[model samples]
Target: MTVVMVEEIDPSSADAGVPAHFGDPVKEQRLLETAVGLVDRSNRDVLAVPGDERASWLHTLTTQHLSGISADQGSELLVLSPHGHVEQHAFVTDDGTTAWLDTEPGAGAGLLKYLEMMRFFTRVEPRDATSEIAVLSLVGPAAAELLPELAEPRIGAVPGPKFAAGSVPPEATAIYSVRPFEGGLARRVPLGVDLLVPRAAKTSVIEKLGVPRAGLSAYEAIRVAARVPRLGHETDHKTLPAEADFMAAAVHLDKGCYRGQETVARVHHLGRPPRRLVLLHLDGIATDHPPAQGTPVELDGRAVGFVGTGVRHHELGMIALAVLKRNVADDARLTVGESTAAIDV
Candidate 1:
């Protein structure tokens, strides 16, 4: 059995008590408005795919058009099971012999397992590179401005992976631009600057710029608002590409035979996936107790589906993501535990 390890970085240590939860509503609002914030996403996993055939081998298994993606261009890809269930998702960047696959936290092991299983027929070698890298996301309107200062200002987007080699200040940090998941630019600046610098400098950067540090709480809120799907929450091994809204972005309908292309193409052309991902707003007794994963959602006393992710929004109240039966009406009523939520269509 192959072993894979994940490295998680604490936001507090990275940003001096920035509160990984971002508890204050006032501060949250300020952070959202400024369009400039530092988010410590050290929990996400980074896998390095190396070997002469890395790109070609990965292109054959994933759902993106990787053959067309160059080192200067990066794109997001989905890894699906033979039955069309989403097993993992990744943002890939290839520099010919080496490819970087950045995936959600706790996903690297499974991805590595899958890759290892597939490697017997290919020439690619997959290795866990999470520990060697630290990921810091700078988002909002100011993202573009801040990113270029640390790395070469590449005028491209990071849909898959874009690479630029640059240096950071006097710390000797290795900086590279990655495609942004949000509507801004992002660069992955590898902090080789003595582990202590990342922990100490994070705070100084935020304070000096007067920008709020975003946490998981705010990250979820913003992601849901943007209708961006979460890997383990809004998607899983049970979800098909179409059902998860991955068309054109993460899935390539025209790609050659992949693990689950048959089901993906059939379901997509049929115009009826088994389930639909929708947003919802819970009615009455709004609190932080959002519905758990797989909690039954109901409409007109009939079971439709289950809640995926729920957030207690200060303004929107209780908002959630749900995978409901395709036939459910737009105004469907969903029940989670004892609370009733209304689908926002």
Candidate 2:
């Protein structure tokens, strides 16, 4: 078995309390936002589903249009509880014979267990591939140009667009790339492209690509700016897919019955989610540090919602994403830590 190795860096280097950075958080963020940046996403977990019933079985499990996705295409998935609360979020891709599912660190084991419990008589089989497979991410305007240089998939040349995707060409092996942001009409200049590579080849590919390494700070900034909600940060067991703004990317309204279809339908049609995710433009000049996760968000001196991920972008200044009451006005002023911030909805 191939073991994925994670190279650890000093935690108290750049932003002491924040996640470690490669070198300078500002420079790394600038690279990700302007030129190009790469991150070792091997820390994330991957689950492989292989068998004749893989496609059909997964289709009946999550909220996404998987039946129509081609062998080279991929989509994000939201695994909701029976009451529509989020249980898991995964990036899923199929290669005709096998389906690859990726999730946040520490969440894979639980996801595998859930899959097993619900599998019943289905022909699908789920196996943990985290030890054998690793993921790398590329971001910025230069991401597209740098993809073909890595591993040219059988799909041929990548299409022109900041957010474009397709399967790796069949002749290729060991690695593959996917346009994680493109999902039908929700087109936008995505944060980056994701490359799924075998664990044994991760180090070699990183050296071969020769892109600047970005740490968690830069990654968090870009993700928050893009309004991407991560598992523990923006989502948890109490979270509803609608509240996290995952409906567009991970939910398929026209799909057949799944775990939490009724609750999703009810919320989308008649009810309003208790809370909604929003980006906050913090008063960096007045704040000493970025608000930590679960920090209180006070409106008019009353607690409403709590903070999630916070980052200071190279050019964008201090920014954070928070889940606030759905009724909170778009222009409402909220307080975080010792400083005030505004919703950038």
**Per-residue lDDT tens digits of candidate 1, residues 1-345?**
111111122332212322345446435534654566665666677788988777678778888766545554455788998888898987665554567787887888999998998888677779997776445555555555654533442222222222122311111011244443222224442211101113334445446545456665565665565566768878756888777666545776555689998888678667688898888888747445767666778866778787777766667777788888888877655677678877674
For each candidate, what is the lDDT? Answer: 0.62, 0.72
State how far residue 38 of model 2 sits from its true place (Å): 1.2
Q: After superposition, how far is residue 275 of candidate 1 from its true place, in Å?
A: 0.8
lDDT of 2 by residue, 236-332 (tens): 5689987987776677665669998988877776547889999998897776578888888999999988888887877778888999988889888
Among these predictions, the greatest TM-score belongs to 2
In model 1, the clashing pairs are 74-160, 74-161, 75-159, 75-160, 75-161, 158-179
CA shift at 198, candidate 1, in angstroms?
A: 9.7
TM-score of 2: 0.82
Steric collisions counted per model: 6, 6
Q: Which candidate is the best by lDDT?
A: 2
